[model samples]
Target: MAHLSLSWANVAIVLSLCLGSISYGYDFSIISTTVGQPTWYAYMGLTTDPTQASLYSYSNSIIGTIFGLFSAGAIFGGLFVGWFSDAHGRKKSLLSAAVINIVGGALQAGSVHVGMFIVARFITGFAAAMLVALVPVYIAEVAPPAIRGLLVGQHGAFFLVGYTVAAWVAVGSFYSANASFNWRFPLSLQALWPLLLCFFVYWLPESPRWLVSKGRPDEAWKILAKLHYDPKDPEQLFAREEFFQITSQCAADKASYGDVSLLHLFTKPHLRKRTLVATLVMWASPANGAIVIYSNIVVLVAGLGFDSADSLLLSAGWITLACVGNFANAFYLDKLGRVRSMVIGYVGCIVFVIIEAAIVAEYGGTTNKAALSAGVAMLFGFITFYGGFVDTTIYVYCSEIFPTHVRAKGMGWSIAVFFLGNLPFLESSTTGYATIGWKYYLLFIILPALNVGLLIYFCPETKGLSLEEINGIFEDKVAVRLTNLTEEERRDLDSRILDGVVGKDPQAQAPERNNVEKSAEVTLDE
Candidate 1:
């Protein structure tokens, strides 16, 4: 839709859907914090002082195992959800995740042993992974192309809202007189978000694209118009055009590939390339090396020579700042376009990481206050830029890259790889900071440097185009991207397709369509 204004109804829909993200975020922050509680250590027969968690060998084993198990669970969860979301439908998949998380959260809160708690963590990871991977697909399907970035980017911002809240609440529990309350109370809070989602999820609209794929075009048309309705444009021309685009493209997609199968993601030449780009981009999203900082922010803050009392407060504030940065990203993202925003993120990551390595290498062991201060500022800068540019853009970019038929499966694989991308940086120990020092930062620079090259040649601009329009770009069905064209140009292109598309049998055009189309790779320059 050209020059569309966001309706209040659409904004409400976006906000309501973000509860799943908030749950995913809260679970993420709560896990990292609850693992550090004194009672948690006691339960595991380890040191009460979490600061010594690393110093103690058994504590290191369990803590590392916990993180590893969570990653494993998340990977499997991603693979499962792709098939589930596509087969059942988007809203059902979301609700299933919420229900699963409710069970996982309760398991986590009331665990009687370390094994149960470990199981609980795995379950929570499974459900949380589904939530994150699926939310963007549903939102992208329904969001107006004009503000698609701004709408879909809310997943990043809202999850961080949960992250920020979990941070402050963990701080509150840390100071509580009751020891078990420190871990149990915060872990129990995980149930709250999914419970909220379960209560309100019925209000959400199903993805119109999914409906069309299911042979429900009349329903899809009504929902699409409602989603993109502009009161000023009473005729809803954009909405009608958008519905036409999705249905026709999906018709062609069905003709090209008989049914949705995981094998198609690997076997189809065009799909294989998309899957590769999505996977690499997802990998690149976490390769920026901010995981080291996020997992150790309180320690990093404390190391800046601040009093212990203020470290947690400052950590919470930093996450909140990152949350704000995500909101800023939501707004600026469409204006910059997905590929450029990601490149800016990669280039910025390389720049700040280099500066950070230099600062730490120069004065890491020294009590030189100015140098310490500069190093701390650089860490904050790196995270803020990464959160705004890279972290926030991953979902928006990946969700739009595939056609409606395979988007869920594509995202599942992408998010699964995303979990793997994070593994290399989970060093979670200051041993690297102290033993390897600045050289550890140097390790992170390589992938993002490689990523900028991958992005320039592999990723294309998807901003300001409908989801079906983007599929056309990948298939080489259009010579010029509609996003870069004038209204007249789009009208001309639409008129040709509209003749065969509007109120006609899609199969009738299949033979002629097959003769002209090519499944070539698309790039920024192409």
Candidate 2:
């Protein structure tokens, strides 16, 4: 029942890294508002119907292209970071991505034509992808295992804040009435978050796990000391034990795998399973139509016969509720196992979206106020479940699944798959919403149901274990060395190898032992 207590330094790391996710959220959600604006349509010359002056009036193709291209750029950006972070380091990759976003944001705000704007959006998408890919990896590496889920859950919480702010900003922008400043000003705010990140991120500590992977254990040890050692603990027991595990594991992994290539992620049986599970986890998290729902929410609400002002307000409320859901996720993510929490989120989304679809099918464009209210409520419920149950767990699962040797690359592959996964959902939204209407949500419902099944079988529960000890889930019960140990030696080795200075909980130890036994049995059968 007790939550992990954080030191001030721990608070600073979580705040800094998690805050970086806000930029992506703001830029990503800001488009929802901008594209809904009449001024945005006019500025882009897509307002063909002057009679529909208050609406976007752009064709499905145009809307699809604008949204789809961002995913395309994100796919590219995600792949690039895998190699870049592994080659350089986590801190440098983040700073570089922030710089790229600044350039892209400037271009977006100052654009004179639609072509110019599209290119700028792609650049920004590219930059934002890097932040999404690397930030979770940084968080997972930096946080203590006891509280890792809570720390990583902050990524989703901060992301919802960005989405909420953008929705309200769009509501405020609507009052301006002037075509030029209305859309341009909101576009310009995208630059502010990355700029703040650039200034402060460089000064924070790099991931000690990453440093150890690069054969710089001395520097890694110093950082681990700073991060984990409390002067109040006279023995320095926890920090020393943790440091030893990290160094020992790095040595063991190097010996086992030799030099790591990305190919090893697929070539080794256990590593391949980790890679697949991690990538699939990323794909499933967003499968519940989060991007589709949020991106086109204003248009969907308007299509339900609400006025532009009311639609914007309604979308803002829906997103605000989602923000609250994410905060709840941050609090209880550690208490609920990752597999259970994610299942709850996915199932919640499926139920809500099905209800929304039914209501919209029955009552859309009608004067049935009750049906309209229910539909709006259903959409809000969808986001609430999506943000809390699904979105919150994606990064935490993906980041924790990989060892340090392949951590960044592993994260990149998963995120790249994430963006690529978005392509089908995002591309379908504009045309699907314009044509099939509420039935469009059926797609979101079906895919996530399948994902839930996939997770139930493959995803391991990763609560309350150190990063080093987590490898036991994948490693052999016996070490891979040529020498054999006596029964007494084996028990001592198991205690040291499986549990560190902090004694293991029976609850955690039981599942972990099962995981190791199951993995070894499976390998033997193979």
Candidate 3:
């Protein structure tokens, strides 16, 4: 193994994981276009009158229910992936997700009945669930602590980019007028993305930390050498040390292959706090009503009296703005601590949503274009704030909050809550839109306020911590002294600390003794 900068390898992993996000984005956005199509209702055998439309729109709920179900599958998949990656490796789990993607995409695109489509979407959702749950874990695992935020943040950034592309495609397909082929083309195209990803993923290396955990010290060193550390240098010594820290934490927590019981998540103190934070973050992101608003933008705008083309364009513009916000977030997330970003975002969402509700209440059913424009602008503002902060930060925060042992399970469980929140809107846009009317925006307002409280109360700062140090935060054992270290010092401590936990080999006892001595000294001093 020769010393290589793992930076390139990390980028490779990001690119591969992004394929799954593309599928997620595509599925979510495709519905917006499909909902607008006359043919879609015809195929589903439904009418489009506002009252009748509510029934037709119940299909959205059906889709959402399936989405939630698949998310349930994903919770399992994510939990399994954690142990599987620890046992079989990250690359293999990714390969497994790709296979699910291919099959699910095929079934969805070719469906002749709603049942088949539902089943296909459910499977695809499961695949997406796993991708969302695992990809961040993979990126966090492979990244240098210096750039972990930037790398993990890229997942959300790219996810928004994927959403932008989906919006563009939706708008194009809406205008294409090839009634026979319009929506299907965009849905089917998503299938090719995961297939292409499979080819590229082969070039990427396995996670170096994972290699060490599996007791392959030489192979781990080889990977570390390629990641820009000298094979024979003491850094490999340091790398081994960091690996043990994670393993020891897993053991102390009783985390193991097949140990990912959902009951354990609630019963274990350390795991429970992690689960709480992750679930709240994930729940907060979708509960703001952004997904509902975006998914049904056409109907929302139409209800406000905008023309169909104009509504689609507005949706496109909002998505474009969201992309910009996502980009800005990716660049600055490391600078802004996760809790701060989320708090600011929730505040912004509350204000904007209230304003949108006000505008709609004042003139939603009127013929005044200016009143309608104000409503639209308010909607855009809500999306802008959402994209800027909550959208991007949620994933980064969720992944960072959990220990590596149950990271996947934690993420999966939280995301399942997110999709479960999605289930209501699918049944009837009216469920939210009619029940609240323009006041529907108010529902979003209240949730973010709750999120703001949760973030301030429960969430901890995680701006510059290494993965191991992050675990220490959850355990409440990350010392204040450790927090004062320079970035370089922190990295060195993380590497040295972890090596002591996992040891150089299973039979090696020297590093474990060293860790015990160091831990005692640190504890006594504190």
Per-residue lDDT of model 1, residues 310-339, tens digit only: 667777877888889888888899898888
- Whole-model lDDT, model 3: 0.68
Evaluated with lDDT, which candidate comes out highest?
2
Whole-model lDDT values for every prediction = 0.77, 0.78, 0.68
Q: On a 0 to 1 TM-score scale, where does candidate 3 land against the true structure?
A: 0.84
**lDDT-best of 2 and 3:** 2
Candidate 3 to native Cα RMSD, angstroms: 5.4
Q: Deviation in angstroms for 97 in model 3?
A: 1.6
Q: Report the poorest 10 consecutive residues by lDDT, candidate 3.
A: 249-258
Q: Please state every model's RMSD to the true fold in angstroms.
A: 5.3, 7.2, 5.4
Model 1 ranges off by over 4 Å: 2-5, 48-55, 302-308, 359-370, 427-438, 476-526
Model 2 C-alpha lDDT per residue in residues 124-150, reported as the tens digit of each score = 889888998888889888787778888
Name the runs in model 2 displaced over 4 angstroms. Answer: 1-5, 48-58, 476-526
Model 2 residue 233 lDDT? 55
